[model samples]
Target: AGEAIITPADKKHPPTIPVTGAAVTIGVELGCAATPQSLQINGNLSNAVEGSVTPSIQGTGTVSGNGSGGSTGGQGGGSGSLSITPGLSATAADTVTTGGSLTGDIGPGTTRDFPIATKPLSGRDGYVVARETRVSVDGCLGGAQIRSYATAVISTPLGENSITTYGRTLFIDRDHPGAPPKLKPAK
Candidate 1:
């Protein structure tokens, strides 16, 4: 992990800030089904700012949660998008017997918007994946649910100038690829 010396939006009175909000993910249940189902969602959110790093780092972040059309089964399918206001919060949630559930948050951090590092801040793209299962009363229904978020930032080392930059997230997956997980750990 790399340490990010965040330049405050205000240059006159700079404050100590770090690059937070790496991403948060939660596994969801897709419910039980007579047949297995595969789904995928894709989206991109980006924002760039240009200003002095004195009183405040001048810039705004604009992200649109518009995912690619989702796949559907013979019975049903799903689709959605998010238009978030700058410095505002947005949320959505729901539940069904067959499809699992998901609750997620994608926006700027409490202290600041994701640092728009001038260069690829080690694009290590650090991320965390979580999984969970919730069974129905009959024990024959319920599926694993998962939700993940990734965050990154970059900037010049202290005693230097800054530049303009931006970033976004890419959600991807292979439907039923059929690649089994390795049972044994690498020696």
Candidate 2:
């Protein structure tokens, strides 16, 4: 991550205040020791930000979900685009169920969008976007990591601006001692 300042090259530069802008660049490398054939990702959306995870598989696989669509509320609204890939299968739904296994098929090399918004009924503290996602990639021997991008818009009296952030999450099967107890341990 890094940042730089840009100064105007106009005559007013003598007394001009340099505008300072920041840029953040993030990168990650996930090492999977074994070959994976299938992949699954259970995701969540919270408080004014939207994101998605894409799993690329070399062979056939199934994904379960409510499909894709858009919704609007008194506060805000969001929409999703459909995946257009040959041999791809999917289910359609107006609302995406939380904490449930999604049922659908995302074509290889394509991605899906999961829109998120803070519920209107949320009380003060606004909303803490804390949720656990379980990811399963068949044939993975070591571990798996997923990365995605999230963006939010900040509105103020001055103006409104959008900012983007990178997110990374790791997946460990219950077979490993580090896995949460709720997850079924390997037999």
Candidate 3:
């Protein structure tokens, strides 16, 4: 969603030093319910980072309804976090970057963790600490199309002279006639 960097005041040069770190924790969860013709699902994912850099990520999603024939509805949401250490490999071109990816269902009472590959850089070597969270929900009412929503956030540290950027994606699906396609037309 959003991120901020804290710089050490003692550093002589700007806060633009390379660093290394690792994710020390990961967690995930899932929930589901079904009737004769209807069904409901929810899940979530969370992660923590330590070592050279520290960051965290979390998300939630759900899917439910009578796919065969009936009424139903669903909804979902999620977010992410990250942290970075400075001066591990101080260099003129030192820099730090972080990012992650998420898929599947995420919702309440659900969480999971994923391992990210560490990259080695010349001149300034730094670690990438990152995590991601996702959530979703879906359902249908009679012949009407059901609805679902999902959200995610990611954060990372940057060199004093560097900048960080973030983005997200959303998908939906329905089986009713006149139902919109899984991917909405770009605005």
Candidate 4:
């Protein structure tokens, strides 16, 4: 997992104005038997100014998972990554970028979520708006399913800004028998 920042328009500003960094933390809990877990996180921030416009881009990614198994128990693992980019086209405006990701696996099932935010960082400043999220899942008893949600708002100092939000959910279950053991299928 890692993060990065790109500056394509800020050659006039000092290099110190643009910086990037990332960090990650992981935790795991097991009831019994052997369990393995791992995690990674990363991100970046950058900005550039050219003429009367400033452009900035930032991104982040994370991956984590756990697995456990006994004589009959099954093992599971999961991971995911996300990123965002924001830019200001004119000198009289600001831009923001944000994103998140998650993934997990349990037994014969898997789940994932991805969220993104794009808007002005400040509300009292100028017109700002944008939001988005998505989710997906798969199960041994079900096949595969996906859902999406989004929101956006535009505001100005003179009046109030418009607001919009939406959400969705999905589910699936299917039976899938993996390859038999090296010997033969369990009776």
Q: Estimate each model's TM-score.
A: 0.16, 0.23, 0.18, 0.19
What would the TM-score be for candidate 3 when compared with the true structure?
A: 0.18
Worst 10 residues of 4 by lDDT: 23-32
Candidate order (TM-score): 2, 4, 3, 1
lDDT of each residue in 40-98, candidate 2, tens digit only: 66676544444454544344445544444457523444455445444434443354445
Tell me the tens digit of each residue's lDDT in model 3 across 110-183.
12222233233322223344434444333322222122221121223542233333223222223433443465
Number of the predicted model whose lDDT against the real structure is largest: 2
Candidate 2 TM-score, C-alpha based: 0.23
Instruction: Identify the runs in model 4 with alpha carbons over 4 angstroms from their true place.
Output: 1-106, 125-141, 150-166, 171-187
The collision pairs in model 2 are: 63-103, 63-104, 64-102, 64-103, 64-104, 65-102, 65-103
- Clashes within 3 Å, all models in order: 21, 7, 44, 8
> Any runs in candidate 2 off by more than 4 Å, and if so which?
1-108, 119-127, 133-145, 148-150, 156-159, 169-187
Question: What overall lDDT goes with each candidate model?
Answer: 0.33, 0.40, 0.33, 0.39
Q: State residue 138's C-alpha deviation in candidate 3, in Å.
A: 15
Among these predicted structures, which one has the highest TM-score? Answer: 2
| Clashing pairs for predicted structure model 4, backbone only | 3-43, 10-48, 10-49, 140-174, 141-173, 141-174, 142-173, 142-174
lDDT of candidate 3 vs native? Answer: 0.33
Model 1: residues >4 Å from true position, as ranges?
Answer: 1-5, 16-141, 151-187
